[model samples]
Target chain A: MHRLILLLALFGYLPAFTQYKPLDASTINRIKEGVAEAARTTNTISSDFTQEKEMTILKDRILTSGKFFFKKEQQLRWEYTHPFSYTIVIRDDEITIRDEGEVRSFNTQANRVFAEVNRIIIGSVRGTLLDDTGFKASYTQSNGNYIVRLTPLLVTLQESLQEIVIYFSKADFTVDKLELFEPAGDFTRITFSTKKLNQPLSNEIFSLY
Target chain B: MRSFLFTSIGLLLLLSGCQSIPPRHLTPVSHHLPSDTFLPTAHCTLPTFFSPPTFQRALFKASMDIREHHLTGLLFIKMIPQLRSSRCDNDTVSLPAYRIVCSNELGMTYFDLEVAPGVFRLNYCFEPLNKNALWRILETDFRLLLSPEAGTTPIKTFVQEESNYLVCKSKQGGISRWDLYSPMGDTLLEVRGKSSLADPSWISYAEYHREFPFRINISNPLIKLKLSLSLLSLN
Candidate 1:
C-alpha cells in the first residue's frame, strides 16, 4: 500500500532502476573529469527551475516554480515567483530567507542543516560533492545521462532524507536535475533549465529582502 | 536539612510544570443588539454553512508553538470520500481526513493525524514530538478548525458587534464555543472555544467567499501559539 501511494505520488511513473552496476575505475575518472571541466571556468549560473513536491495525501502535485542564481565563493539565491512569493539567499556561509514581507538571516555556524544543505547543493553544482564525506556515493547511467546518487551516512541526515539524486547532463556535465527522497516515501524534484554560466552576476543578487 | 529543602523545591517545580495547561475563564456574552427580542434556544438548528467544513484537499504551511519550540512545516490534507452503495448511506458515512500528513522542506514527515469524525490516528511522528499532551492540544485545535459538521447550536446570538454580522454562542458542560458568521450567515468568520479544563482557542477566516476560507489564523493565547496560513492555490 505504501508503494502504491509512492507510485501515485510519482505521477504514475515508476522509475525503474536497472541495477547499481557501479562504474569501473576508468569510467568513474572520465565522469569526474567531465564535472571538473564544466566547473573549471564557470563563475556564475543563472537558471529557472521548477520545483514539484509529492505527498501521498495530496491528489495533485504541489508546484512551485522559481529562478535560481549562483556565484563563486558560495553565493546563491532561490526566488519563487508563482502562486506565492518567497526567497532564500546564501552568501559567505550565511543564509537569508524571505517569506512574504518578513526577512530573517542565519549563519551556517548556527545551523548545521543549512550549512550541509548549502554544501550539498553548491557542491553538486560544482564538482565537490564527490569529496563530501557525509554521504556514500554511487553512480548509474540511464538515457546517456549520469546520475550520482548520494545516500546520507549521518544519522541526523538519514532521519530527514534517504537519498539525494543529481542528474548530470552527459553533454555539458552540468547538473540538470536534483531530487531529494525523504526517509518516508515523499520526495521533491527540482529541474533547472535555461542555464547561463560564466556570466558577470552581481553581488546584489544575493542581497537580503 | 539541605537535602530536604532541595527535594521540597524540586517537588514544587515539578508540580507547577505539570500544570502547563491553563484553566479557561469564560464569561457570559451580553447581547449587543438593543431592542432585540428573540433569544437563541439551547439547541437551535445551525445552517450547514456554520457546520464543520469538509474539503477534498488542502495544503497549508503550518507552525506549532509549544513552550520554547517553534515547529514549522507543510500540512497536506486530503478528504477521502466515504464509500456508500445506496443513496440512503451517503449522509450516514464519514471518512477519515484532516489526518494532517505534515512534512518539512526536505520532505521528512513530522506527523499524520485524523483530528475528527474518526479516531485520532498518530500514524507517524518524529521523536521528541510524540508527546501525548501536545497531541491532545493539537487535536483539539484542529477539531475546532475543521469540524464543519459540528452540530452544536447557539444558546445565544450577538448581532452587529464590531463589524461582525452575527455571533452565536454554544456550551457543553464548562466548554464554551462561539461561531461568528457573515451578514448572510453563509460564511463562518471565526470559531472560538473555551473551557475550564483548557485555555481558549480560536480560528479566524479571511479573504474568502463560498465554502473555503482563503486564509486562516488559529491561535491560543494561553499557549502563546499562532498558526497563520494563506491559500496559495486551490484546485
Candidate 2:
C-alpha cells in the first residue's frame, strides 16, 4: 500500500528554482491562516496529476499520470491511468483497490501501513499536516509559492522517509506540488493540474464497490 | 498382560513411523519419454527466447501468488553490459549480469536484485519479503528462467515422434533439467525438472510476439508458489 500513498502524494509542480528566502514569523502566520481558511471552505477537490519517481538503480525516471479526488470528511480516490491502470479509494477507514481486473478491500485499522496512509493523505488534503506533532515544520518563500518543509520526527517514519516539502500557491493557498524524500536517495514528486475545488462530486465515486 | 504388550508394540510402531523423514530433493529432469530414441547430439543451441545476445531490457506486468498472499507489480529487467577486458572464449563462461527490480503499481519497490553466475546480490527488499528462504527461492527461480547459452552444458537429445517435439536433457550439480522444444528447436515450449516428492517444478511460455513470449508462467508445486509475467513493453 506504499504505492497508494506515493500515487496520492505525487501531485507536484515544476522545480524551477526561483529566488527563495525565509518567511518572517508574521508572514508565516498569515500564510497558515489563509491555508486553514481555504481548507475550511473547500468541500471537494478534483484534479489531474503527474508523478515522477527517481531511483538510483533505474536507468530513467518512472513517470506516471493520474486523477485525484477528495471530499469532505474522509473520502478519497486516487487513480493511475498511465503505463498501467490502478485505482485506490479510501472512505471511512477502509481502502478499496482495483488493479487490472482484480478488486480487493482492507480495513485501515487492521493494517499499520494502510492506517498511516489514510492519516497522511487525509491530513494532506485537509491542510492539517502542518500542525501534526509527528513532524517539525519550517517555512520559506520562493517567488509566488510558500514552501513548507516538514521533517519527520517519528523514528518509524524517519527510517523510510526523510522529509516532505509542500508547495502552496500564494494566490489561493492551494497545494500545487508535493515532494517526498527518502533516506535511501529516492524521491517522488507529484504535481496537480486543472484543479477544481468545491465542485459537486458524485457520491458514487466513493463507493467501496 | 497381553493388552500391555499390544500397547507397547503400537507405541513402538508409531514412534518408528514418525521418525523424521528427510525432505524429498528435486532432480534436474523428469519425463516419461522412451529411452530408445535418445541421440548423442554434437551441438545444442538455445532458443531465441533464452538467448541474451539480442536482449537488453524489458518491462512486464508481474503477479505472484504464494501461500495465501497475492502481489501485483511492475517488473523491470536489464542486462548489465560487460567490459571488453572481461570477455572470455569459453562457451560456458560466467553468466552475464542482469539487474531486476519489482515494484508496486505506483512505484514502491518490493525488491531489487543483481544476478549472475554464482553471484547473487540483494540490493533492496521489503521487510515482509526479507526471509532467507524466500530469497533463495527467488534466486533459484531466476537462475532457471534466465539460463545461459545451451552449449555450456553437455546435453543428450531425444525425439518424440508421436508428440512431434524434442527434449534435451542436461545435468548440473547432479540435478537433471529437461527442455522441451519444437521439432526445429527454434521455440522452447516448456522446461521441467525432476523431484522426489511431488510433481516437478515447471515453466511454460506462450503468446509469442516478435519471437518473444508475451506470457511466462512459473510454478513450483512444492512451495505452492506461482509467478506469472506478461510483457508490457520492451524498454
Candidate 3:
C-alpha cells in the first residue's frame, strides 16, 4: 500500500486534448536521444505544480497545489501547501516525510518498496523510465508534446495501477504533465508550470528537521 | 424428530442469547417519558452533533491504528442533498446524503463510499481494505456518525439522574445503541453501541469550534481497532 502511495504520487493536472499518433521506430529513437540529452544537461529543477484527482463516484474534484524541486542524481522534494501541508524529500538512500509537523524518516535501502518508488519518481522526471524494463513502454506524439505511456508489467503494481502517462514538451523534452490511472476508474493528474531549470538550490531546503 | 429439532433450536437460541450486548446501567428517573408512551411516536427527535446545513463538507487528517498496522490519510466528507422522488406530491422533501473519501497524503484514494439514511453504497475500496469484516465495521461507524435519524426504529429517551445526561436508546437491525447528550440537549457527548459485527464500540466527540467537533475518537476494543480524526479544514 505504501508503494501504491508514491506510485500514485506521480500525478498532476491534465493537459488539453490533442490528437496523438504512434511514432515510428526511427522517430522514437531520435526523441529518446533528445530527452536523454535534455536530462543530462539539466542539473536542477524547481516548479509549481497543481494536482487534481477525479473519480466517477465523486461529484467534485480534489484539488491540491504544491511546489516541486529536484537536484541531479537523487535529491527531490515535494511540498504541498494548499488544502493541507505535507512534505516528502528524498536524498540519496534516505527518505523523509513531514506530515502534520511530525517528521518520519526511512532508509530506502531497508524498504524495497520505497526504493522502487523513488527510482520511478526520479526516472519519470529525467525521462529515464523509458528504459525501465519493469514496464512496457509505448510512445505517442501530440501536436505540443510527446507522451510516454508506461504499463506496469509487475503483478503487484498491476493490481492497483492501470497505467502511467507522462507528457513531455516537444521543444525541450521537459515534463509538462503526469497522470496515473487506477484500476477502479479513478485517475490523478498533475501539471507543472513556471518551472525553473538549472537553478542553484541549497541542501538545507531538503531537510525536514 | 420434529420435537427433537425444536428442542435443538430452542437450545441454540438460549446459548446465543448469552453473548448478546451487555445491558447498559442507567439510573431510572420516575418522571422520564419513554418515546413509545407518546402518540404517533414512530420516530423521535434526537440531538445530533453535526448540523447538515452548516456542515456541508469537512476535511480531516485521519489515522487508523488496528492491531499492528497504522495507516494515515486525509478523510474528505461531502454532504449532498438528495431530493425525494417526483412521484411524491411533496417534491420539497430532501434527505442528507454523505460522500466520504479517504486518501493518502500523496492523493491515492483508499476508499470511496456513499452513505445515507438506510442506504449504503461502496463505490470504491482499496484492495487492502476490501474485507467484509472491515466493511461491516466501517459501515456501522459511518452510519452512526453521519445519519442516526434513519427513522426506521423508535427511540426511547431517558434522563440519567446520576450523570444528568439525557440518554437515548434505539435498536435497529438487532444492534442496540445508546447516545448520551449534554444537559442543554444541543451537544452530543458520546455514543456507546453494539456493532453489527457483534463487537462493542464507543465513539466520542470533543473540542467543538463553530458548531463542529475538531476531534473524534472511535474505539472497538474487541477488534483492537482505534481511529482518530482531527479537523484539517472545512471544505
Instruction: List lDDT for all candidates, in order.
Output: 0.69, 0.72, 0.76
Give the TM-score of each candidate.
0.77, 0.77, 0.79
Off by over 4 Å in 1: A1-21, A57-59, A109-112, B1-54, B61-73, B82-92, B103-111, B126-132, B152-165, B169-176, B182-186, B194-199
What does candidate 3's lDDT look like per residue over A1-209, in tens digits?
A: 98777655544222322356677999889878988988999989999999888765555667888999999888999899987788889998898988788898878776444565577678977768989999998999888888999898988667667888889888888889988787777787889999999999988988899
Chain A, model 3: TM:
0.86
Would candidate 3 be rated incorrect, acceptable, medium or high by CAPRI criteria?
acceptable
Determine which window of 10 residues in candidate 2 chain A has minimal summed lDDT: A11-20
Q: Report the C-alpha displacement of residue B9, candidate 2, in angstroms.
A: 24
Q: Write the per-residue lDDT of candidate 2 for residues A60-177, one digit (tens) a residue.
A: 5667789999999889998989877888899988888887778898787764444655676677678898799998999998887889998888876675567888899888888888
Model 1 C-alpha lDDT per residue in residues B1-235, reported as the tens digit of each score: 9999999878765654454332223222353434454444323333342232434666776566666655555677666545334466546654434546775543456776665454467876776677776666666666666653355334665554456456566663334667767755566777777553445677788877566677788887656667776665444
lDDT value, candidate 1, whole model:
0.69
Error of 3 at B65 (Å): 2.2
Pairwise DockQ winner, candidates 1 and 3: 1
lDDT of 2 by residue, B145-229 (tens): 7763345668766555456566667753323466777766667787765322232457788998788899999876656778899
For candidate 2, the docking band is acceptable
Residue A13 alpha-carbon offset, candidate 2, angstroms: 21
Q: What would the C-alpha RMSD of candidate 3 be, to one decimal place?
A: 9.0
Report per-candidate DockQ. 0.37, 0.25, 0.32
